[model samples]
Target: MSDELTAKLDRIPDPKTGKGLQAAGRLDGVAVRNGVATIVLKVEPDEAIDRLKADIESAAREVDEVDRVQIITTLQRPAGGGRDKAAPRQASAAAPRPARQIIAVAAGKGGVGKSTVAANLAAALAKAGQRVAVLDADIHGPSIPRLFGLRDIKGLRKTDTGIEPADAHGVRVVSMGFLTKPGQPVVWRGPMIQGAIQQFLNETYWGDPDVLIIDMPPGTGDAQLAIAQTVSIDGAVIACTPQDLALDDARKAIAMFEKTHTPILGLIENMSVFLCPHCGEPSEIFGHGGTRAEAEAIGVPFLGEIPLTIELRERSDTGRPVAFDDGPVADAFARAAMAMLDSAREARKPAPEIVFSS
Candidate 1:
């Protein structure tokens, strides 16, 4: 049955490439179950998404066994290879948002719990009565959707104002994860990444939140450059583990923000230690105080340290941030959030003018 549907879909033309859907590689997958057909389509941004979806749905319904048709659309990587010469966009071209403060949470490399920190921080802020929005700009490795328990969201609604963000626990959420399937890889180029960031900032109606936390992708790469140059970032909070290798990358992240002139609010040391739940023994698994030491060396405030524990991981996996409830981890994140707010606002203050004696 699925094969028959695929053959039918193959006859439909893809608007972007001017070829049959299958020939253009637009038909990603087709499955039939319980008299319902599920079709996955890879789409380009400028293509007519609705028209293509309608065409495919109409064709799928013609099959005798298919009682309903559901189309899942995922973004395709932009065209162009190594020869492309376009430079990164300037800050003047960026679309502005109404959020009072924009904070970027970054990690020098992957596996550093950057997304976890960002989500918990947003939750903590929201719990404190501040309107918060989180833009999961991780692109290729967007985990904000899952951390917030919104993994099932496949798309967003477009109104006269802009794209509507998904709300979870009082925080407005926007992420590339919502558009793509679970475990699906985003193979976009650098230019595509920058463009997506612009769209998220410009097209999403963030509703004048008090704080906008951008969950930055691991490493100082295209996404980082895009956010730095595309918007007036109030400050950046760096997340890193307590290890030599992680610290090496953390330094690079700090340098990137410095070069971009984005204020470094502070450094957060995640996974500082592991406390045995049963025995209550503390273990410095990654070696402790590395991030604080680095923060002191760089003249930036050390926000706080997050201890590694089974509860923290369990809460993150189950779509409940530990910070939402009252616990030791929650307390630590709350403190970090308070420090970040203070540091960011202070950094935003204008330099005092010096008057020399005439």
Candidate 2:
């Protein structure tokens, strides 16, 4: 039995480093008694706790002889000593959320490249060496799976902690597309939609990303309200074409976020202009700078603009986001993404400490 437990521990991999648990020295102490396995882990507070828990549970399941698994994690201070016993209780109560920041990319109406912007922004952030995740909360029109070429991916695996998210384009992705079949229309009512959004927040395994970009459904409806209540949204990025009609809806979107007390990070003026690929001439096909003017009028930062290029549409349709390839469109997305990050930084407050005691 002891040998079996050792074998199981040997097979367990460190979720952060992807090395075997024994190789990473994460499996410090192990004791098996009567088919129950007990393990002790010494980890840093910055380590991915959700991943660690999942790895241990997965290893335990692989060992048929093990009926149950117990894991205990202890945090060590930077001074090579354990945490002080007298640490303030308030410190624990003020624990920060998993991700340092969460930005929602939303639009007043569809066809404004909201999801495209969200996906590309997440990809560009990852390219800039920031850990990022994209949550496709557009239940009725989830395009994230297709954008990242994860349409055929399997459902997320459940561990002791929560459901694990899929990885693509160096960014973690969770989408309602993964939950329902292809081409199936989701006709869920308000309560059900709200419940699903809540599950995405509380149940999905997001690990410890630096930022999370939520692709909210287009509108200022019940879905938007549910997201506001479910997640601690650090800020919102409203996307709109430079058209009067779009700007009108965009203002409503911004107002909705403001009413919920979520900071408006900035506004993205998508489709601000269209450039002829061959002629190199720019044209305001939808009437330009309306979103920017609206942002300024409403007291929010104007992030940047993206042109309506043929390549942008083709790339999106092919499941190859423009951000993944180098070109004018890629550069545009990178700039827009950086601007959003800067706005988020300006809007953020210091994170509070979290304390966990056994």
Residue 72 lDDT, candidate 2, scale 0-100: 50
Score each candidate by Cα lDDT: 0.86, 0.78
Q: Please provide, for model 1 over 1-358, each residue's C-alpha lDDT reduced to its tens digit, 9 standing for 90 to 100.
A: 9899999999998776688898988876787766767777776655667777888999999999998776655445556634222233344433455488999999899999999999999999998889999999999989998899999998777799988999999899999898776776776656557667767887789999999999999987888877765678899999999999999999999888888878899999999889899997889999999999999998999999998889999999999888999988899999999999999989989999999998
Which residue segments of model 1 deviate by more than 4 Å?
1-95
Best by lDDT: 1
lDDT of 1 at 295: 95
Estimated TM-score for each candidate = 0.76, 0.70
